[model samples]
Target: MNDSQALGRISAVVSENDVVLFMKGTPQFPQCGFSAAIAKTLSQLGVPFTPVNVLDDHAVRQGIKDYSSWPTIPQLYVQGEFVGGCDIVHEMHQSGELAQLLRDKGLL
Candidate 1:
């Protein structure tokens, strides 16, 4: 499918899932260190999430960068909204805001 169509699918995945993580690989085997780190952070927070493997889809891999304007993989979406990447997540975690955010979204 084209970029638009793939983005549409990704949008649906983000919208339908409460916590969606667009990462390099599956949650079990994140291809990038940043991806794995964020996965671990989310896990420690005890939040259930859906992981989208962008490595499997080139269109999506690029489309998401355009979509989020964040220029990175392993993007996080909570309650159908963009929540930034590893650095942001780590910052939030450090401030005790990540757990609060997850609790607010009822995902923890």
Candidate 2:
């Protein structure tokens, strides 16, 4: 499929699921440090999410960037909204906002 098509598929995955994390690797084997950090944060918050491994598909890897308008993997989407990456998630976690947000979305 094309880039937009690939991105549309990923976006549908995110939208259909309550908590979706498009990361560089799986939850058990995060490829990047940031990906691992985000995984840990999500775990710590007890937010159950489906992880999409970008490494599994090149189109997904590049398309996700275009999908979010953010040039990064390990992107977090809550209720279909692009929530940002590790740094932003970390900041939200530290400030006790992440949990609240998840709860608000009924994902926590």
Candidate 3:
């Protein structure tokens, strides 16, 4: 897909899923450390999420970074909002803020 198409697809995916994770691999088998970290955090919290493996599609990998303007992989979207990446997620998890945020969204 072209850049515009990729962006459209990303928008649809984010909007369709309550919790979307655009990562390097599936939650069951993350391709990178950063991806695994965020996946594990969500798993530990028992949050059901849709994991989109960016590695499977080059267009998506680059498109997502542009879409979020975050310049990183393993981006998390909660109820169609950009959450953050590994370090931010880990920090939030440690501070109990992630859980609170999930709860607030009625996702947990």
Candidate 3 error regions (>4 Å): none
Candidate topping TM-score: 3
lDDT of 1 by residue, 1-108 (tens): 799998898889988989989999888988999899888998887888899999998999999998888899889999889999999988999998998988887777
Q: Candidate 1, 64: how far from true, in Å?
A: 0.7
- Give the residue spans of candidate 2 off by over 4 A: none
The lDDT per prediction is 0.90, 0.89, 0.93
- Tell me, by lDDT, which candidate is best: 3
lDDT, residue 105, model 3: 91
Root mean square deviation (Cα) for candidate 2: 1.0
Kindly report which residue stretches of model 1 are placed more than 4 angstroms away from their true locations once superposed.
none
In model 2, which residue pairs have backbone atoms overlapping below 3 Å?
none
Query: Lowest summed-lDDT stretch of 10 residues in model 1?
Result: 99-108
| lDDT head-to-head 1 vs 2, winner | 1
lDDT of 2 by residue, 1-108 (tens): 778789788978987998889998898999999999999999988888889999999999999888888988789999888898999999999998999998887777
TM-score of each prediction: 0.95, 0.94, 0.97
Q: Which candidate, 2 or 3, has the higher lDDT?
A: 3
Clashing pairs for model 1 are none
